[model samples]
Target: MESSAQLVIFAGLAIGLIYGAVGLLSGFCLMSSMRGWLAEGDGRLVRTYALAVAVAIAASQILAGGGTVDLGKSIYLQPTFSAPVLFLGGLLFGYGMVLSNGCGSRALVLLGRGNLRSFVVVIVLGIAAQMTLKGLIAPARIALVQVSQATANSNSLPSLLATLGLGETVSRTLAAAAIVVALMLFAFAHAGFRRSPGQIAAGIIVGLLVAGGWFVTGYLGADDFNPVPVTSLTFIAPIADALQYAMLSTGLTPNFGIATVAGVFAGSLTTALASGRFKLEGYSSPRHMLRSGSGAALMGIGGVMAFGCSIGQGLTGLSTLALASFVAVAGILLGTAAGLRGALRVQPLAVA
Candidate 1:
């Protein structure tokens, strides 16, 4: 049994490394997709992002139907719900992403491209994430969690459909098919978008990566004696945890997410160096530094409040079809829009 568990852990590490490598290489980013669509009139990235979400939903639901993993075990689709936190957190995170000129995932990708600004954003985001997750701000997070008073049983749409008299298998299949078809249709509807092979492949691979994380942690990492936390790619808390782990690795066993985070930076650095993209850069002005720092802090607090960052709740949590994830995604979209053009607009500044 111990050997079997070790095998599973190895499998998870491999999967996470692959995900990190692919994400760093391809520049797959939800924040960028939405921002491109809204700000630049380039719909390809957003369409690709939507397709990835659809793929994640379909693949994850199929896994659940096959009894390969239990989606309900993850936190995003908790039995209890928190509408306020999800929406509010999304709002803050969305604006922060724009203010910082990228989302958490984007920050990682840019960090790989040898952008010092992204490094700063990520460090601040990680620390703020720690504060909300288990640091000084944890009490406030717990208090907010307590106040929301929302509830749900299953995380997927199938679970909700099951309560309406649909059989589990049938509900899961139908729900998954619907989302998948809608996303595909949306993606292919645009002639320009369909022509972008890089974006399309990025969408598919990244979506698979999200589902892969689920399979690794939920299925492979399951152990009776030494259980692993059910999680997928989420940058905010993981970054914070990664920072802490660096200081206390002796006391902490490495987990799937941490390994993946490390792999992304290493993978990106290697790619950058090999491609001659490596360069040391810093903020050109104190104002720029301040904006980046505050944006990172907002992302940390908001990501914790909402329970996941773009990759975490948006992709991983969505894979489970959790209602909370859906709500949170909606909030992220709204927040991103607000940051871009809403009353509380956060203008994008150039990274130096």
Candidate 2:
């Protein structure tokens, strides 16, 4: 209805388009990256992910520092959060990712490429996420959060530093710089990774997309009459919301998330067609379908509890340097490790 909201939606579309194209071309999925690095002994993809995180932090903090956006308004910076719930959610989501062989965003990309199995995953995940967010599971999720939640005066790392005598700007800059430097080092340490320009570009573009989403909602969409929600690129809630909006278009107005989700699908489809890579694919067996469906359910439920998916918490949430984000991410990493290694590891499915 509002002009600014329209602008935000259009901006979201553009960001999603770029992200879809880049993701399709670069194979940028956290599960794939982790599998490559840990399971396959290839570190280039993981390094690309690390670089993206580093760049996202740098770019997002710059926007905040310039007063272009209020990071405080984002969900990651809430004054009260349940660390235990978030961590558990992250674990569930991570393990689900491994079971499903990818996360929500990855499933979207695959769907764009005509993967019918991803279609199943997307549908199941959306329904499950919606259930967790506002349907039957909402009560349990709410009860758990209420029981485990904790409140704090400083909800973010920079804000925490601010209370320790540093100026607001200084604290933000210091924290961002320290984290960025460490991530960059990890991203660039490998010679193979350093030599790959395509992966490098993918990281940079994806990171900028995260910041771009923030700018679209926080700055461009800021209106005195009807302000858009201050958010960045994340997949879990958006996927559920998208599915709802698709069915209830007569009553619901599209938001940035829904538009972005559509854009990702469209963008990926265009890319796949153009690249001659589109192919219809399906599950190899009934067991594969069962595993995939189960995994999607976990992702939907866990993502809701954690307040984000892998790309959501791993990149966008981390950009805010929120303490809860760190806890969630740690849980995600641990969960992924469990799935990728040890006796609990998910074994590869045999082709039917």
Candidate 3:
């Protein structure tokens, strides 16, 4: 038990450290990438995001193919997928992330750099996620899940392709390769993106971290006596878990998510301090606080509903080629666009 726990902790922290360092350096926010593309007509960052996703899928699939990881055991590959939860949750999370000026993962990084406003966002997001997960909203959320859930032949595209008559290995290989190649071509086609090596490295590192996350949890962390849930980078539930662990650690054992959450903060803080970027920051007005708080709440609730946040469904879950992840990512993009231009825009800076 102790050895397994130690290994899980070590694994989680290693991956988390890489995530924090690379994420901070790269400014890897899916919401920001979407905004850059839609609002600013800039595709460079978006391409970076694509590269990360592409690399993650290829690397993870390779692991699965070689039997280094059991991708099916992950929650993203469940037989039944909650379409409503993913779509609506992704929508809310997208808009809320925009409103907060960052996603949940970004908030953690910012908080590490002494952004008190991010602290508020993190606290609200954590509490709201807990509420949606198991607090006051759980009943309603579960009811929604029960009604909206649909059982699929398989949630993964490769599996679906296999079922449609292709050889299983061929189906998986072809699908994964196609997506990977397409995304890579798209990412590299941008001349500006091609010129930015730092950004490219960032994308690759982030993607490998996702694959590393799978390897750590699925293989190294897997144990019959003290099993850990196989998962990768995600912020919603883990934020809540971190909060709960801080309060009730005596009664609860720290898990991968919680450890990852803490490592992100620690890693970011260290990097920020070393880079001389640490500075105290807070809301400028009461209105700013209210706006940020509302956005945080929305992110928490929406992330749980969707079963993951931007990075969760966007990079990690999508890496699995899960159908629900596709829908959820689409919803996130749509919602982000809506928030950027439509009447639903949560523009506290401009609107307030």
TM-scores for all candidates: the values are: 0.93, 0.99, 0.97
Q: What would the per-residue lDDT of candidate 2 be over residues 1-352, giving only the tens digit for each residue?
A: 8899999999998888888888899999999999999899999999999999999999999999999999889999998999999999999999999999999999999899999999989999999999999999999999999999989888889999999899999999999999999999999999999999999999999999999999999999999899999998999999999999989999999999998898888889999999999999998899999999999999999999999988999999999999999999988888888899998899999877
Arranged by lDDT, best first: 2, 3, 1
CA lDDT, candidate 1, residue 138: 91
lDDT by residue for model 1 (153-256), tens: 66568888999999989998888888889889999898988888877887888788778877877887787877777777677777777778999988876667
Better of 1 and 3 by TM-score: 3
Which lDDT tens digits does candidate 3 get at residues 131-193? 999899999999999998989987888988988789877988998999999999999999999
Backbone clash total, candidate 1: 4
The per-model lDDT (C-alpha) reads 0.79, 0.94, 0.88
Q: Which whole-number lDDT from 0 to 100 does residue 238 have in model 1? A: 73
RMSD in Å for model 3: 1.4
TM-score for candidate 3: 0.97
Each prediction's RMSD over C-alphas, in Å, is 2.1, 0.7, 1.4
Q: What are the clashing pairs of model 1?
A: 79-152, 81-150, 81-151, 155-322
Best by lDDT: 2
